[model samples]
Target: EHIKNYSKHIDEFRSQANSQGIWLFISTLGCWSVNIPLIQVIAAILLFCIFIFNSKQDMTEKRAFHKIEEDIAKDIDSNLIGDSRKARLYDLGLVEKYRKAIKPVLKTSPIFIVCYIFYSISFLVFFSNLFPRMKLIFNF
Candidate 1:
C-alpha cells in the first residue's frame, strides 16, 4: 500500500513537471502568435503564472513523497514472501525511475527564465501580427 502511494506521488509529480514545459511552450508561441505587444505580454504572463503554479505543485509533491519515503523506510520489513514482496520491489523501481526522469527538468527549471528572456527578445525583433495578414496571404 505504501509503495503504491509512492508510485502515485511519482506519477503525479511527473505530469506536473511535464505540464510546466508544455505551458511554457505555449506561452512562448503566444508571443509569436499575437501582434500586439501588450496583449502578447499579458498572455505570456498568465501562461507563466500557470507554469509557476505547476512548479510549486511539483515541488510540494516531491517533498511529500520524500517524507513518505522516509517514514515508510523506517517501517519497511526485511522479510517478505511471495508476490507481495516482488510487487513492492517493482513499485520501488518504478517510483525511482520516474523520480530520476524528472530530476533533470527540475534541475534546469530556473534556466527556463533564460528561455523567457530570449522569447521576449525574439518577439520584439520579429514583431508581426499574422492574424490580420492571414486573409490577404491566404486569399480567403
Candidate 2:
C-alpha cells in the first residue's frame, strides 16, 4: 500500500517537473523575441532562476526516490524483488519523459542564440547609421 502511494507521488512530481522544464525552455527563447531591453533582461533573469532552481529540486527528488527504491528493495521478499525493480524502472521512465518533453525546448535554444546574435548585429548597425544621420540632420 505504501509502495503504491509512493509510486503515485513520484509520477505526479515527475509530470510537474517535466512541465516546468518545458515552460522554462519556452520562456528562455521567448526572451529573445522581446524588443525592450529592460523587459528582456528582467524576463531572462527570472526564467534563468526558475530553470536553475527547478533543475536542482528535480535532482534532489530523484536522489530521494532512488534511496526509497533501494530501501524498499531491501525490505521486500525475494519474489517481490521484481515489483521493487519496477519502481526503479519507473524512475527511469520519468526521466525519459522529461527528456522527450524538453527536446523541443532544447532545439529552440540554438535558434534563439542565432537570432539574438543577429539582433545584436542589426542593432549595432542601426545605431551606427543613426548616429551619422542624426549628425547630418542637426549639422553636428
Q: Which candidate wins on lDDT?
A: 1
lDDT of 1 by residue, 36-108 (tens): 7678767767776776676886564546566776665544546565687666666676666666675654664
Global lDDT of model 2: 0.56
What does candidate 2's lDDT look like per residue over 26-117, in tens digits? 66567767777767667766766776687557643454666665565555544455766677556645544543465643553444444445
RMSD of each: 10.4, 10.7
Please report how far candidate 1 places residue 12 from its true position, in Å: 2.7
Top TM-score prediction, candidate number: 1
Error at 63, model 2, angstroms: 4.6
Cα TM-score of candidate 2:
0.37
Cα lDDT, all candidates = 0.61, 0.56
Give the Å shift of residue 129 in candidate 2.
Answer: 23
TM-score per candidate, in order?
A: 0.42, 0.37
> Which stretch of 10 consecutive residues in model 2 shows the poorest summed lDDT?
104-113
